[model samples]
Target: MLQNFLVPDVLTHNYLVNGFCKSGDLETAKWIIIDMLCRGPSPNCATYNTLMVGYCASNDLDKALDLLSTMSTCAIRPNRVTCNILVHALCNKGLLGEATKLLGEILEDKPESKTANLITSTILMNGYFKNGDISSALAIWEEISKGHRTRDVVAYNVMIHGAGLSLHHSLAYRFVCEMYKKGLMPDVFTYNALLSLLFKEKKTTEACYIHGVMSKMGVPPNIISYRVLIQGLCINGDVDLAKEYLHIMLEDSVLPDIYIWNSLIDGYGRHGDVQQAFYIRDQMVASGIFPNIFTYNALINAIAREGKLVEAHNLKTEMIFHGVYPDVVTYNILIGAACRLRHVHIGLLLHDEMLKKGCHPDIITYTQLLKGFCLIGKVINAEILFDQMISSGLMIDHVPFQIIIKKHWRMGELDKAFENYQIWLRRDK
Candidate 1:
C-alpha cells in the first residue's frame, strides 16, 4: 500500500527509515535515507536528526558527529533534537566532560532554544550524578531553579533518581516532597525512584506502601515496578512471596526478563530449595529466557550444598554445551565444592582446565585449593602449591597463610606453625 500511494517521497521514506532506526537496523535506515535523497525530496534536519540518532544509538558517535558536517554542507540546520542526541550519547557513554562541552556549544549556538537548554541541563545533571559528583549535580539543579528556565518534572525526576542511585535516601525523599509541593504529581518514574530507594535501603514495607499509593493514585506500574518488588522480596529471603509476585507479573502480562529469572534462581537456591532452583531454571528456558553464567553458578552452588557432586559437575558440562562458557566464578564454585567434598584432584584438574582456557586464577582460586589440600592432610603438597602461587606473583592473602599455619599446628609442627604465623604478622606490617 505504501509503495502504491507513497511513491518514495521523503514523508513515506521517513516513516520507513524511523521504523528501521527504532528497530536498531541503522544500516538499513541509512540506505533508506540515501534513497530518499536520490529520489529528490531533499532530506531535512529531521532526516539527518533521525539518522544521527540511529548512529548514536549504535554507539558510533564519530559517525553521528560526521553527520553534522554533512547536514551543514547540504544547508540543513540541526535542531534541538540533533544536539540533544549527541549530548545524551556522550552522557550515556560516561564522557561527562565532552557532553558538557557539547552542551555549551548548543547553548551558544541556539541561545533561545528552550529545548536545548532543558535537554543540555538535564544531561549535565545526570552525567554529574553518574560520575559520582553529587555536588555538581545539585549545583546544576540549583542553577536551574534560579535561572530563567523553570524546573520541569523531568528535571525533578532526574534529581530524585540520581539521589536514589547514590543511596542518598534522605535527599531522594526530600525531592519527593519538594516535587509534590510544586504540584508536580509524582509520575510512575517518581514513584519508581522512591520504590527503588526503599528497596535498596531494605525498607520493603515502605516500598509496599509506595506501591499502594501508586495504585490509589491510578499510576500503573511498569516492568521496573514489578522488578523492584521481586528483587526486594528475594533479597529479604521471602522466596515464596517473591514467587507469588512473579506469578502476578505473569498474570499482569509483564514478560519476565533475564534479571527477574536470575533473581528467582538465586533466591530459591539460597532458600535451600535446589529443586526449586532447577525448576525455575527450566521454567526460564521454557519462557525463552536462556540461562547465563549467573544461572549456572547459582544452580552449581545449590547442588554442591546438597552434596550432589556429580550433578554439580554435570551442570558445568551442560553449561559448556549450552554455549555459556564458565567464568572465573564458575571455576571457583566448582573448585570450592570439590575441596569441600575432599576431591582435591578434581579441584586441581579444574584449575588446570581454567589455565588452559586462559582464565587466570585469582587469589581465591589458589586459596581454595590450599584449603582443599589442608583438609585432606596433604600439608606438604599444600606448601608446594603455596610456593608456586608466590612464585607466580599472586598476592598472598591471609586465608592461604592461615590454612598452612593451622595445618602445621594440627600436625604437631609447633615451630613451623609459629614460623608461618610470624611471617604472616610481618607481611601485615
Candidate 2:
C-alpha cells in the first residue's frame, strides 16, 4: 500500500521512522532517514529527535550524540523528546554526572518546560536508585512530591525496588505505607518486589506479613509471588511450611512450575531427606508437570551425596531417555560425585561427552575437573588441562594456580613450581 501511494512527506517519513524505531529496526530506520534526506525534504527537529530516540532505544549513546551534533549543524533545534531520550540513555549507562549537566542545560534554557520537569526528575530518581545512592533518590522523590501534583506507578515501583536492592527493607515498607497515605493502592509489582526481597533476606515472617497485606488489598498472588515464598520457606528449613504454601497455592488455582518443585526437592535434599524428595518428584510427575534439568540435578546431587551411586547413575540415564539433555552444571555434579566415589572412568567418560556436546567448560567446570585429577594423583593430566585452559584464553585464578604449584612442590619439582610461581607473581603485580 505504501508503495502505491505518492511519495511520502516529511511528517509521513517521521511516522515511519518512529514505527521502525519502536519495533527495534534501527538500521532500517536509519536507511529510511537517509533516503528521505536524499529526496530533498530536509529532516526537521522532529526527524532528528525521532532518530535520537531510535539510537537511545538501541543503547547506542555515541551515535545518538553524533546525531545531536548533526542536528546542531543543520540548525534543527532539539525539543523535549530529544532531551528525554538523551537523559534516559545517560541514566541507564550510569553516567549520572553527565545526565545532571544535561538537565542543567535544559532548565537553563526552558525553566518552564513540562518535559524538563517530568523526564529530568524521573531520570535522576531512577539513576540515583540504580547507582545505590539512596539518599539522593529520596531527595529527588521529596522534591518531586513538593512540586508535582501527580505521581505515577512507575515512580513508586522504582523507589520500592531501589529500597529492596539496597537492603533497606524497613524503608521499603515505609514507602508502601506512604503509598497508602497518598491514597494510591499498591500494585502487583509493588508486592512482588517486596516479597522477593524479603525472601532473599530470609525474613520469612516479614514476607508473610506482606503476603497478608497483599491478600487484604485484594491483589491475588501471582506465580512469582508464590515461588518466592516457597523458596524462602524451603531455604529456612521450614519444609513443612513450604509444603503448606504449595497446598495453598494449589487451592488458589495457581499452577506450580518446575522451579517451585525444584526448590522443594532441593530443600528436602539439603535436609538429607532423599526419600521425601523422591516422593515430591513422583508427585510432580503425577501432576503432569515435566521435570527439567534442575529437577534431575537436585535429585542426582542428593542421591550422590548420600552415596547412592547406583540410583544416581540410573537417574542420569532416565534424564537422557526423557530428552532432558544434561547441562554444564549436571556434568559438574556428576563428575564431582564420580571423583568423590573414586570412579575415575565415569568422570573421564562424562568429560568426553561434554566435549562432544560442544559445551564450553567454564572456570568452575575446569576447576572441578582439575581438582578431581589431582585427587586421583593424575598430576600430569591435571597439568595438561591447566595449560589447555590458559591457551584457550581462560584466566587462571590464584586458588587453582596455587593448587598446581603446591602439587608440583610436593612432588619435589621445586624448580618447575618456582618458575610458575614467578610468572604468577608478575601477573599479580
Q: Candidate 2, residue 35: CA error in Å? A: 4.8
Q: Cα miss at 344, model 2 (Å)?
A: 3.4
* Residue 226 accuracy (lDDT) in model 1: 81
Q: Give the Cα error of residue 22 in candidate 2, in Å.
A: 5.3
lDDT, residue 352, model 1: 97
Task: Encode model 2's per-residue lDDT on 1-429: one tens digit a residue.
Answer: 457976678888899889999999988888887887777467888888887888877879999989988888878877766777888899899998888777777766745655456667777788888998999889878877786536666677788888888889888878877888888888888889888888878888998888878888899889988888888889899887898888898898898998999999999998899999999999899989989999999999999888777788899899999999889888888877887777777877888988999876677777777777877899998899888877877777887788788889989999979987987898788
Once superposed on the true structure, which residue ranges of model 2 sit more than 4 Å away at CA?
Answer: 1-15, 18-24, 34-61, 64-76, 111-119, 133-153, 177-184, 243-262, 268-296, 310-325, 352-357, 360-363, 366-429
lDDT of 1 by residue, 214-240 (tens): 878989888888888888889988888
Residue-pair clash count for candidate 2: 0
Model 1 scores a C-alpha lDDT of 0.86
Which segments of candidate 1 are over 4 A away from where they belong?
Answer: 1-41, 113-115, 282-290, 320-324, 356-360, 390-429
lDDT minimum window of 10 residues, candidate 1: 1-10
Instruction: Give all TM-scores, in the order shown.
Output: 0.85, 0.72
